[model samples]
Target: MFSPTSFDSRRRTLVSWLLPVALAGACSLAWGQSASDWPTKSVRLISPYPTGGAPDAMARVLADKLSKKWGKPVVVDNRPGGNGFIAIDAFKRGAKDGHDLIQLDSVHLAAYPYMFKKLPYDPAKDFQVIAPIFKSFMYFVVPTNSKYQTIGDVIADAKANPGKLDYGSWSIGNPVHLGMEELAQIAGLKLQHVLFKETTQLYTSVANGDLPFTMGTAGTAGPLIKAGKLRPIAVAAPYRLPAFPDVPTVAESGGPKAPYEVSGWNVVAGPKELNAAIREKIRADVAEAMAGADVKERFINFGYESLALDRKQLADFITSESARHENIIRRAKIELD
Candidate 1:
């Protein structure tokens, strides 16, 4: 029973079990230590929008604050184009140490799945959304010289001349397009959608009275509105925005009373390989940066309302938005290759 061979066999089995456990513990400790000391070098914040837009501005602001806090250089890399695929692809190929982060919008995370049949990146597997940066409501804008005074007038005219009243948006399957489609379906109106290559062209058409109306942000459409070229009939929000207090809500302007709101939002995301501790660290650091006075003022100037959602809450919000977009896309019958 106490033979040397039997004793050696028992010792070998114990060593086999203990060795793996010890190695696992060492690996876990390493991960924790690395996470705690994340951003060992410069960080890259990749943005899908060009340098002038609100998202780009937000990215710069975030980068500055995070850089100061982490004592590392945080740079914003703009790789805009291909409907944000360029920036996403770049992020996928970038570092996985949580130093390479991305700025994604509601469309990229929530609506793209329902809109496209094939995508280069997988929303669930390729990335992790950490927190929401901001949320902005789209304003229903018409020409200043337009005869339509309220959303009710637009609806009535659409009903009177079915398929004659037209609206414009930059692209298909965008928030403005889907939101207007939802509005048409709900109001039982036959309307035509005119597509433009850019916001300036779309708003220019609206101001010239070639297009009846289109949904736009205050930042994108504010200059024309200030120049008396475009008049905001209503905003797709429950309450009036502080920047445009005179503008009425959709319900106030005689749209559906069921709170027909359409808003676009942006969030911070990173590669999925980032550990939980690193993600939380970034989330916490971002929250702190957003709370700064300078960041708050900058967001307001960009017509963006800051969001204070944590990781789980952001994920849930994205899921709910996806479901909402799915319903809208199904009813609107929108699909892309």
Candidate 2:
């Protein structure tokens, strides 16, 4: 028979070895479970646009797809006011997890820092960008019955009339406003800016002849253009859009084109300091969703160009875009009220 001391020693050794193994297995299981149990409840996707806008449309599509992927409901909260501060603020104040996603425009990230004298938030520190949702180039549009047929015609008329050429946009620092400001500056013409409550109002004013010209996304103006209420004179892109094959690019439209290719874009981002695993999962799923045929078709129908970028790439891109806008805004001396 084994001595009691020897048996006790062997038992202690076995227990010691099994304890570590069991603990490790438990830790591994818990780690896996935490990831699997993510999105414990409904996800909130806050949008900075009102109803019937492109961002809202895209968010609803994304919400539905993400809901299916996460096995949870995803809702798009539309809060449209205070130049996107209201929605963004709510997102910041809400959940710190990846469930609180926000649809942000590139201008909000890139140009606002330079445009505003004092911004309310620090974008670099307050958010982690997961991916770019979509892009839409601006269309230099006017009422169909207007005499200005081309970009050059509009420039000539604006020069002759000075500040009488009134252009409209939803806000002052938005890309629709700043891009036109840059174009007008390059062309050396005097123009007046008329701000409206929303994109529908801004584009409607252009169609109603209340506003002579405005740079807007295709989704905002394409229907009116198709309805003969608006005419696109120039596309703020390097090449003409496939959908608008007849519309000329800014360079081709005889305008003084100095990098007039800044397109408006929206991005997906989560709350600050969210868990990295959840963020990565969100990014991966969104990338997969963007690859699907239905999402692609929906984006196309909304006049949005799909762009796919991973988390790191999107972060780097946002940094570079902010730097680029800083240079342009500083050179142009664009200051807002």
Question: Could you tally the backbone clashes for each prediction?
Answer: 0, 0
Deviation from native of the Cα of residue 143 in model 2, angstroms = 1.4
After superposition, the stretches of candidate 2 with alpha carbons farther than 4 Å from their true spots are 1-34
Query: Which number leads on lDDT?
Result: 1
lDDT score of model 2?
0.75
lDDT of 1 at 184: 90
Q: What would the per-residue lDDT of candidate 1 be over residues 1-337, giving only the tens digit for each residue?
A: 1233533343343333223212222221124445567779999999999998877888888999999989899999999888899999999999877889999878887777666767788764577677678888889999998998999999999999999988988787888988988899899998898888888899999999988898988888877998899999998988888768899998999898755788899888877666666766788899999888887787656667778776546655665676677677777777788
lDDT of model number 1: 0.79
Candidate No. with top TM-score: 1
TM-score of 2: 0.84
Clashing pairs in 1: none
Error of 1 at 139 (Å): 0.4
lDDT of 2 by residue, 1-337 (tens): 2233533443343333223212212211122324567988999999988887777888898889999999999999999888899988888888776768899888777778667766677664566666678888888999888888888998889889988988887776777767766776677877888878777788888888988888877788888888888999988888877657899998898886655675888988775556656666787788887788998877666667778765445555665666566555665667765
* Candidate 1 least-lDDT 10 residues: 20-29
